[model samples]
Target: MPTLTLENDVRQFLGSITRRERRFAAAGTLITLLVLVPVVAVADPGLVPGTPAQSATEQAVDAARGDSCRDTLPADTPDYVVCRWLTPPQDAAAVAAFWGADGGANLEQAQPLPAQYVRCNRKTDLSTSTTCKGGTTFCRQLPSGWYQCTDETNGKVTYERYVNGKKQVQSTPPPSPSTTTSSTTWPTSSPTPSSPDTASTPLPTPTPPDETLPPDGNPPDAGTPTTDPTTPSASVPTVTAEPTASTTPTTPEPGNGAADGDFIATAKKARLRIWLESDLADDYLAGDTAFTAALQQLVTDAKRTDVTGVKFADNLAYTGFSTEQQVIRFLNRATQALRAALPGKRLAIGVVVPELGCGDSQPCITGLRKRAPLVTKQHVNRYLRAGDVDRVEIAGGLFGRTYRQYQVTDPKTGKPTSITPALATRAQWMSVKALEWDTLAQIGVREYGLAHTGDTSPWTMAQATAQIEARIGTAIGLGASTITLWGHKATADGQTYRLLNAGLADNPTWNGLTGQGLRGRLAVVIDPTSTERGAADIVHYAKGVSEIFILI
Candidate 1:
C-alpha cells in the first residue's frame, strides 16, 4: 500500500475509490490507512498508548478515513499556501498562537472572523489581497497560529481561533461617528464708536432768600403796622355788612295731617272712574237728625271738590218709617231730596234684598218678597226717566247668610249631621241676570252709568271697599271707560253726614285714597233736607266730605 502523508493526497485517493468493486475497495482502505494514520498520531500524540502500534495505526486510519476526521490545517502554514498533509490541533491556545499577536489576542478573546477559504473583495479587506470586495473581507491565518479579518470600510475586526481548546469565531461592529465641533472662532476687532453724548447738564439750585413775607400781607415783624392809606383799615368798620339775606322764599311745609295733593293730582291724571258707598245709611234714615247735617255737608263737599258721581241706598228707603206706606213715601221723598242736593252730579240707587228667613216675621218676609221687587224696579225705572238715578246696584243678603248649605249624611250610619250646599241664591228683588233691565233703562234714558252689586252683609267695610275697587279695576282692564256707584241714605241728613264724613276721612282727595291705589273719580248725593245753605258753608262742608253710602 502506498503511504498517504499529505491531507490533499488522502482526499484525492478517497475520491477515486470504487463503489461496487471489492478489490478496489480493499485497496482504497489500505491506502487510506497508510496515508492518514501517521498524520493523526502526529497531530494527537496523546492517543491511548496500551494498544499495539499496528492496531493504533489502524484506529487512527479509521478516524481519518471516516466522517469523524476534521480537516483542520496547522497555523504554521502560510495563509495563501494549501496544506497537503498536516492536521491542526483544536486547542484555543494553539489556534491563538498561530495568528499574529493582535490577531491571536482577538481570537483568544473569542471574536468572530470571516470563514476560512472564503474569498472577499480586496477593496473591502485590510490584508492587501486582490480578491476582497469593498465593504467586505476574508479571514487569513497569521504567522503565530490564529486567523483574523478586518472590515475595510468600517475598521471592524473579526477573528477565528481555539479558546479553552475549542474553536470559536468573533466579530465586532464599528463605532459611530463623533458629532462635536473640531474648532471655535473668536472676534478679532473692536466695535464702532457710540453716538456723541447729547444728555443735558443739570441746572444749578437757587439759594432761598434770608427773609420771607408773612401770608397775611403784613411784614414778618408782628409789631409793625401796615400804614398805606389805600389799604383797608384793620379796625372794625362803622357799619359792618351783614350777610345778604337769601331772597328766595321757602314754601311753608304742609301740615302733618294735610291731604296729599300729589295723590289727588295723580288720580286726576289717571282719570279713573270711581264707586262710592256709605256704611251708615240705615242709622241715618231712622230719623237720626245729627246725621242729616253731616250728610248734607258730605254732598256739598263732594260737589265742591268736583267728584265724578254719587251713590245712594234707595233699597233702604223704608228705614225712616215703621209702616210700608211711610217707607214708600219716605223713599219718594229721599229720591227728590238727593236729586235736588246733587243737581249736576250723577246719582245711583243701590238696593239690597234679604235672602235669608226673616226673624219670626213670616208676614214681613212675604210682604218684603213681593213688594221689594216692585219697589226696586219701579224706583230704578222712575229715576232713569227723571235723570235722577244714573244706575241701579242690586245687592242682597243683609238678613241671612249669603251662601247656601246642604245636609251631609254619614255613609256608615246613614244619618245626616252637617248641612252643606252649592251657592245660595242672593235675596235681591231681581236676579243678577236682571241687571240688563236696569242697564237697558239707563241706555234708553241716555244715562252712562251701569249697575253691579255684591253680597252686602257677609262682607266687611274694608272687604266691600276692596271688592268695589277690584270690580272697578276689572272693568277698566276689560276696556270699560266708565263705572258708577249708586245708592240712597237711610235719610237725607244721615246720607249727607255719612257721605261728607266718609269722603273726608277715606276718599282719595282727603285720606290719600288715590295714593293708596283707589283710583277713579266719585260722584255723591245727599238726601233731601228743608234747610238752606250759604255758598261758603256749602263749599266748606262739601270739601269736608270723605266716603259714600252704600245699602247693606
Candidate 2:
C-alpha cells in the first residue's frame, strides 16, 4: 500500500469537509459542544489549496487548539492563568452562568466574558482555539470574540472584534500608549478628589486565626472574596473599611488577641518611618494602626516590651511628571513625615519596586509610572539616597493603579515553569523585580519585600504563591536579611495574606525562608481588619474595575 502522508490526510479532510457541527442531545445541566481539533503539527501546512483563502465556515472549522482545555492548573503554571471554554461555546451566557454558579471555588466569579479585540486583517473567528491560519494568523483570542493581531492591523489605529463567531474586522481605539505617549502631566484638571470614609469603621473580624492559618505555610484556599458569590459586581463589595486619602490614621482595632501574641509582645519597641502614597485607597495608615496596636496590646500578660524597628512603607507612585527632582521631593517629604510619626529612631522601609503598573517607553514620573527613567535602577539609587531611606522593598501593585496587560510577566526566570499569560504575551508583561533589587543593592538599601504587590498582581493563588517563592529566592541570592509578604487588599480577599503561611514555612533547597531565597528571610503579615471570608481580590477587581485592569 502507498504511504499515506499526514499532509495528504489534512488536505483530504479540508477539501471535502462539509463544515456541519455535530448535534447531540443535551445531557448535563451545563451545556457545551464536543469540539474536534484538526491536526496542525504537519510541517507543511500549505497542503490546502490556499491558506487565508479558506471560507469563514472552513476557517471556523479549521481552528486548531494550540493549548489544551484545562480545569485544574498544571503545577508549574506561572504568573498568569488561562481559563478555557473546553469547546467553542454556543451560549456565552450559559457558559458564564455555569462557571458563575461555581465561582469563588477559585476565580473571583465566572465573569461575563469580556470584549478583548484583536486588530488583525486575516480571520480570527475561532480565536479561542489555535487556527490553521499559520503564523500569519492573529495569534491570540478569547472565547468572548476578543482577538489581537497587532502586526497585521496594517498601521491602522483600529481594533478587531469577532461577533457571533464571525469575523468583524476594524474599529478605532485611542492610539496605544506606546505609539503616541499619553500625557504625563500632573492631573490638576481632573482631580476628582475624594477620600474613603471607611477608615474609622472597625474592620470586620478576621476568621478565627487558628482555622485559617495552616501550620505549614500553604495559603488558605483561594475561595474568599469581598463580594458574596451570588452578588453582582456592581453592588458595594463586602468591605468594612477602605482607607481614603484624606482619612486620618487611627489606632489598629483588635481583631484577635494577637494571633501570635507572646512572640510579638516580648519584641522591642519598633520605631519605623512611613512614607504615605496617600492616593492608593490609603491602605498603609491602617497598617500603621495595626502595627502599633499590635505592639501595645498584644503583649503576653501585659508584658509589652519596647520594640526597635517599625514597618514604614516608602511607596512613591503616581507622580505624573518624569523628573529626578520631582520624585526626590516626594521622598524627602515622606521621610520628614515618618520621622515625626516616630521620634525615637526611624527604620526606613524604602520600597524599591513597581507599586504601580507600567508600560515600556513611558517616563517614570508619568502617572502610573509604567516604564521610564525615574523608576529605573540608575535614578532609583539617587532617589533612595535623597530620602536617606536605606531599607529596600521590592513590590508591585500595592497602592496606585491596577496594572494593565503590559505590566505583568510570567516567571520564565525561575523554576517549575508553571505560568502562561492568558491575555498578554510573556514579553508584554515585563517584570523589573530584579531591577528593583539591583537599585536597592546599589544604594546599600536593606532589600526584600514587605507589604506590597498582591493588590496589583493579576495572578491566581498558585501564581502568587510561586511569585513569592521566586522573589524570596532572588532576595536570598542578593544577601537579603528579611523577606515579607503583605497582601494590601487583605481585607477584601484572603488569597494574598495566605502567602504569610507560605513565607513562614522553611525551604531547605535555596536556604530560603521562602522559595526565592538563598538567605532564609521570610515574614508574613495579615492586616488586623482583613478577613479570610472576603472575595478573590484580583478576580473581583478585574470584573468590578474592568476599565483599569486588563485581567492578565
Candidate 3:
C-alpha cells in the first residue's frame, strides 16, 4: 500500500484497459488534430484483440507531407502538390462520384463532395481567382446592329455598335482629316473683325497678296470700260489681319444702315444661279441693260450713304455646276455692274464650303460634297495666285438636314418599291403583324449631319457653333475669301424653307464664334452677319478694323 500507491496504481490501470479503450484514450490526448480521427485498422476483425495500432497523429503527418496524396494524382504532379479531394478518407466515397477513377481526381477537381451531403459546404468560386485567362475579347455582327461582346468571367462585359472594315469601301470618299485640310498656305497678315472678339493664335506665316482689291469676285475679263480688271489697284489700303483678344459675343443691332423692309437677294434669287448656267443668263447680261443699270444705281445709292464694302453673298459654287465658264460669266457680269458704282471700295465673294466632322455619329460630306464643284477652289486659287485679294471671312450657322426613306411608285408592278410609313397601306401593318415586311419608321441612327436648308430645324446652339468653326477652318485653309454656311429665307421660301435655325428668335447660333478657341485660331467672329468685318465697328467706331470697308 506504501506507494504501489500512485505509480503502481497507474500501471495496473493501463494494463487492465481493453485495446479499443486504450486507442480511444490516446486519441483523446491528441484531440486538437480533429474531433473524430479514425484509426483505419482498429476495426479489422482479423487482428488480435490486444495488438498495438498505428496512431492517428502519425497518419495526419504523412498526409500533410502529401505522401498519401501522391499515389492518386498524376505521376508528374510535384511532391509538394496534393490532390486534396482524393486524399481525405472520410470523403473518399463521395469524391469518387465526381471522378470515376482514383487517378482521375487531380488538384483541378474543384468540387469533391456532392452539394447535398456536405453539411458545411463552404465552396469557393474558382472563377474569381486572379489567375486570368487570355483572349476574352470578341466581336461580331448581328441583324439588329454591330456588336462587340466580351468578358463574362469576372463580370466585365460590353456590347457596343462597332464601325467595321466595310466603312473603307464606302461609295463616297472618306472625310478629310482635320489637319492639313488644304494645300493652299494660310496668310499670316489676316485682318481682324470689327467686333470685340480677338484672335487666339497669330496668323500663318505665308504672306497674302498685297490688297489690290481687283473686284473680289470678278471674272478674268470682267473689267468695266474705264478699268483694267487684271491690274492690281495700288491705291487700295492693305487689309491687315493683326491678332486680337477674345471678347463677349453679342447680337448685332438691326439698324446698321440696312433697310428694314429689304429682303435678302439670295432667297429671292435662289433660281438665279440655275439661270446663270444657261444661255438665258448670257442673253440677260447682254440685253438687260435696264436691269444692270438698276443694280448699279442701288449700289451707288448705298455708296452715297455710309456703306464701305459690298459682298455678293450667295451659294455661287454650291453643289454641282454644269460648266465653270457659265459661273465665270455670271460673276463677270455682276462685278462689272457693281464695280463702277463704288470706286476704291472693298468687294467680296461668298460660296458654300463642304462640312467635316458632322452628325451625331457618322460624318457625311454628301450634302456638303454636293455643294463643292471644281469651280469653287479654282476661283479662290486664281485670286490667291494673283496676289490681288484680302483676308478670308465666314458667316452663318449650320443646321441638321435629315433625309427620310420615301417611297417611289413602281412602273411595272404598280406597287411601291420600298414602303415608308406614308406608303404603308392600313391593311399591311395593323391587320397582319407577321406579314408586315416594310414600314415607314426610320430604320436606325439618322444622319443629322451638316445643315444645308431649313428642312432640318434649329440645331442645338453648340451644333451651330461647331458648324461655324468647321466652315471657318475650311475657308481659311483653302485661301478662300468668304464662306456662306447656310442658304437664306428672307424671301418667299416660307418659314419651313428657313436655313440654320431661321424661324427661332433667340438663337444661340454664332454665340460661341467669339470664344477663344475660334477667335484665337481663325478670324475673329464679331460681325452680326457672322462675317469678319475687317473695318471699325461703324456704330461704335472705337475698335477700328484694318479693312477699308466695315459691314456697316
lDDT tens string, model 2, 1-552?
235687788778676753211101111122232322222221221111122222211111111322221211222222232334333323344443443232111111222222421222333323232331322222244333334445442433334443443344565443554556423223343332232212232222222221121111112222212111123432221111223333222323433453234223222112111111112112322356543443343222122224333433333332232355645665565456545654554244434333222322132124322333244433554565566554555442132212231232222222321111111111111233223444443222121122222333223333333233333323332234444444333432223433222333212211222232212233333332443332222222121111110000
Instruction: Give the TM-scores of the predictions, in the order they appear.
Output: 0.27, 0.31, 0.28
Backbone clashes per model, in order? Answer: 75, 36, 15
Model 1 residue runs over 4 Å out of place are: 1-266, 275-292, 314-320, 356-387, 396-552
- Best-performing candidate as measured by lDDT: 1
Largest TM-score belongs to which candidate? 2
lDDT value for model 1: 0.31
> What lDDT score is found at residue 104 in candidate 1?
26
Quote the lDDT for 17 in model 2. 50
> What's model 2's overall lDDT?
0.30
Q: What TM-score should be assigned to candidate 3? A: 0.28
RMSD to truth, every model: 58.6, 22.4, 34.3
What residue runs in model 2 are displaced by over 4 Å at the alpha carbon? 1-263, 266-305, 319-327, 333-346, 350-382, 396-469, 478-481, 493-497, 500-519, 529-552
User: After superposing candidate 3, which stretches have Cα over 4 Å from the reference?
Assistant: 1-286, 317-323, 329-337, 353-376, 379-493, 496-505, 514-552
